[model samples]
Target chain A: MVTVLFFAAAKEAAGMELLRLEVSQSLSLLQLQQRVLQLVPALQPLQSLLLWAVNNQYAVPAQVIESGDTVACFPPVSGG
Target chain B: MIQLTDQPLDYAAITESVRDPAAGAVVLFLGTVREFTAGQQTEQLEYEAYREMALASLQQLVQEAASMYPLVKVAVVHRLGVLQLTDVAVAIAVSTPHRAQAFAAGQWLIDTLKQRVPIWKREHYVDGRVQWQHPSQEAAVAPVVGEAS
Candidate 1:
């Protein structure tokens, strides 16, 4: 299971912090993004602009997630 | 000290930290809470952050600024919790040997911190509605140009 975390506007919009999902390691970041969009349809329009991080490191679209990795997706930060 | 504070900020203490004889120029940037957004009247703002993560990122940013310019010092403090209108929400100070580098480095620190740090703010409206300020999609991704320790 991988943990998905949210923050800021995404957290307020989703009304939650973390979610646990059981998925295979074959899932690429791109595919995982699509899965998130499926779960939170409101984020569909934001998919392209969202930034992702796996286990606290910035992630690229092609990166694959380990089963226990914590994945975070949120809008571009604005935290001066 | 570079920090993300949960209490009221002390501007004098922050300003004093930039004093250095080697620095002929010092620049300070303060971001304040405004009472209006778009057309609506704002009541207050609540800021939150992933504390440890935010602090780590801010420290990295300060180290990078120090190396990029001939800067003697760089500090950033962002306040969390409830903030009234006109309250100072964030402040950044950079000191360098020249005016140009100090100004540029100070601006870069504020702009880049907004883009890369993990802090968030929620605006409370007069009507009891609340909204989180989302990041603008149009902001330029100011490149991370220096080595961070």
Candidate 2:
């Protein structure tokens, strides 16, 4: 299972802060993102702008995800 | 030092933390909540972050700045949660052997933090409406100035 965390506007739009995905095999970050968007269509609009982090570091769509890894998604930051 | 806190920021303490004997210049930058944005009157602002990633990103930025510049000390503190107008949102201090490096490091730190950190801010207007301020979403919303409360 891979855990996906959401924050700020993403959390509000997702209606939950975290989701545990049951992955039968290894999946690429792009596939993971697609799965997440399927489950939470509210995130559709943010698909292109969402920033992904894998295991606490910035991740690209091609990054692979294994079971037990944590993924976090959020919109572009505006903090100073 | 890099931190994300829910409590109010102490600028004096932040400034003191970066004091170094080898450094001849120290630059402190504070980001405060403003009463207006694009002519809109803001009541309060709420900040949120993916804490774990935010901290890691902040530490990385400090290290990168140190390596790129001749900085002696660096510290950054960002406040989370609801904040009133004029409240300090973020504070950064950088000390270097020269004023030029210190100023450059300080500016780079704050600018990079705003772009890379996982923190987000929500603007609360007096009209009972709230808007999330993010780089990708800002252009879609029209500016609506609000009356002061």
Candidate 3:
């Protein structure tokens, strides 16, 4: 299972801070994004602007996301 | 030292934490909650972070800055939760053997953190409107600004 976290505007869009999704095996982040949207469609509007992280590190859509990892969805950072 | 906190930021403590006897200069930078954006009055701001990632990103920035400037010590703290205008929302401190190095490292740390950290800010205007501040989502949430609160 992958623990998916949402932060900032993305959290508001998703309407929850986080959720756990069961994954049969490792999948690419792009594929995971699709699966997540299937479960949380509210995030669709913000998809283009979202940033993704896997296991606390920035990852590309093609990067593998294994079960038991933590995936984060957020917008471009604006922290000082 | 790097952290994300819901409590008020103690910038003086952050600066002191990075002080090193062997370093000739220390530089500090604080990002405060501003009162205005454009002509609209800002009542306050709320900060949020993807905790684990934000902390890791801050540590990486410190390490990167150290590699670039020979930093003696570094501390960064970013405030989460609500903050009123003029409150310090973030603080970064670095000590180096020279003033130039310290200043350069301090600037780089703040600039890089803003771009790479997994933290976000929500602006609350005096008119009761709220907006989230992603670089591209500047106008995403709120209606047009009106008279101040």
DockQ of each: 0.43, 0.44, 0.42
- Reference-based TM-score, model 1: 0.83
Candidate 3 deviant stretches above 4 angstroms: B136-149
Best by DockQ: 2
Clashing pairs in 2: none
Candidate 1 per-residue lDDT over residues A1-80, each given as its tens digit: 98889877676666778778898556897788778778887776666666676665566779887688888877766564
Worst 10 residues of 3 chain A by lDDT: A51-60
Query: Where does candidate 2 chain A have its weakest 10-residue lDDT segment?
Result: A45-54
lDDT string, candidate 3, A4-64, tens digits: 9998888888999998999998899999999998899999988778778888788778988
User: Model 2 segments beyond 4 Å from truth?
Assistant: B138-149
TM-score of each: 0.83, 0.93, 0.92
lDDT of 3 at B84: 96
Ranked by DockQ, top first: 2, 1, 3
Let me know the DockQ for model 1: 0.43
lDDT by candidate, in order shown: 0.78, 0.87, 0.84
Docking class of 1: acceptable
Fnat across every predicted model, in order: 0.48, 0.65, 0.65
